[model samples]
Target: MQTASGDTQSRLPDTIVDESALDELLSRPSPALQSFIKTVSSPLVILGIGGKMGPSLAALALRAAQAADHPLEVIGVSRFKGDGARPWLEKHGVKTISCDLLDAEAVTRLPEAKDVIYLAGLKFGTAQNPSATWALNTLAPARVCERYSRSRIVALSTGNVYARNEVSRGGSIETDPLTPLGEYANAAVARERIFEFHSRRNGTSVALLRLFYAVELRYGVLVDIARKVHAGEPISLATGSFTCIWQRDANEMILSALALAASPPAVFNLCRPEIFSIRQVATRFGELMDRPPRFMAVETGLDLLGNPKKVCDALGQPPVTLETMLRWIAHWVTTGGRNLGKPTHFEVRDGNY
Candidate 1:
């Protein structure tokens, strides 16, 4: 990563806006970011921006554009462009373009760009469509990257790319061997391969963020666990160590990585400073909610992973603390957390990660 200096504030063109409000995007400056920074121009495109992380990511990009004094034309893509994500995006002035990304034709013909934040994925739990998941998560990005090789790409990957035991290897380095345990990880792995093929072929400067757990009140494992316990449901435990970061912190980490992409096809584990145990998480949630967290602890051997030392050393702050994360989920559940939602890949059972 480049030495992010105070001059970053000054060298920042008239377009630079105060990053105080956009904490997630401003927390760190990646090597790719500095490189992307020098070349900030309008017509920025965020593929699959109509989904989960799109709104926040787009907003942050605009802020970066504002700081640089370059007028940014942000395009957010998805199946349809209204209601679901429209409100959140419009609140930040991000433009939307509707297209069912999984349709190869639509994805193939999508406009090329300067910077593309690829965030679309079929990322729910086992209960989702496997083929659909494969197509959306890995295949689509691979295709999109091929079409837009000229654009700087930051494809979101998961820490799942690392095998379970590999995570405990003093921080699973990006080069660790293939050990994806489930369909989700398999898809992510395939996506990375696709990027590699195109990168070598077209010299695409792409960054694959092997993100770990990103927690927020409404999403992730903690929230699901909280809802189950609150509703008096029985939970099972899995055996594995895991890592987590605040959603905002992960976002900042990603933005930083974007600047550092040029140093080869880089993979940075996006997580918090602490590696947590399943027991600790369960206990924490129980304490905060003032409810007993019931569970049958068993070994699933899944990779309950954590430890984000790399990014912490390079960037500046830890995403979310264990205590704060628990508190946030607890408060959210009490306010109206709802059913465990449609069990995402992160629905917790017992003490497993």
Candidate 2:
């Protein structure tokens, strides 16, 4: 993926945080984002904004509003167990609010906004604590939707809502039947239903974005694989294929989806519009890192994949490409770039995440 400047390597430095590279990347405004900013009113509330992608998404909204010359308030809501995310978001002109969405009173007290982005959910560790996963995924959305029933909401969802598919068929489309495995995936389905029910009952505009995986320098499927390869660990090919999008690309898409929210709650799969071979991607990473790629499992034909044709047609191809992201990830990892220590369990097939 060639960067916006077409010089992929020279632009991205080793220190993403110290130099505010992530801020710059996330805040870069495009036509779609600028247009979305103009359509919505002030005070866009991003619920559950403490997750891996929440801060950047909130900052992106703030910057886009600024760039559009229609500056509006952007508030980030989260438990904020620590001060790290709050400080960064506050510094970026996003109002930070520490509110646990699980608490009904806390949600009721939340300042209402015209636009809301739902990024809160639990995925990993669902095997042990299934109740928490269900509660976070289902109950949280119910509270958010009930509180802001009239706001145009772009809720984040997971592609895991769809069962595994073969790489040959281009992956699952939005209209495909959802037969997701595991408690977490089922919980995700319930989350969408809650949002849909609210949309129907209250005429709240809703858009559910089912993302496969998002990759960046610090944390993502690519980063996880790169770290494993760097540690001389064997890459698993059990789930042979996957779909992913660059972090900024995914964030931008999420922002743009605000414009696509409908009364009946539209569904869009958020990912690169192509199926990627794990072996091929890992081998490419190995070649870039000058490390021999090690493989450990037989390629299983079934895997979680998504068809982003609808979104691609609506928003066009993401600015960054898979190849460009690989180059960036390779450079970042080789030069001792930081990882968020959050591993995406892309290898898990039994829905036991």
Best model per TM-score: 2
lDDT of 2 by residue, 199-302 (tens): 99999999999998988788899888887777789989998889999887888888888888998999999998878888988889899899878999989898
lDDT of each: 0.64, 0.84
lDDT of 2: 0.84
Q: lDDT winner among the candidates?
A: 2
| Residue 4 error, candidate 1, Å | 11
TM-score of each: 0.80, 0.94
Superpose all Cα atoms of candidate 1 onto the true structure and report the RMSD in Å to 1 decimal: 6.2
Model 1 segments more than 4 A misplaced:
1-39, 64-70, 81-83, 125-128, 166-171, 299-302, 337-342, 347-353
Of candidate 1, the 10-residue stretch with the lowest lDDT total is 10-19
RMSD of 2: 2.9
User: What lDDT tens digits, residue by residue, belong to model 1 across residues 1-353?
Assistant: 43333443333222112233323333334333434554644577777776556666677666666665567678888775454677667666888778876677877777767777777776664345678777877678767876778877888888777666643455576666767577767777888888878887888888878777666555676766677777767566664456777665566556556565652476667776566666667767777778787777564655546455665667655524567667656776776643324444453422122
The Cα error of candidate 1 at residue 227, in Å, is 2.0
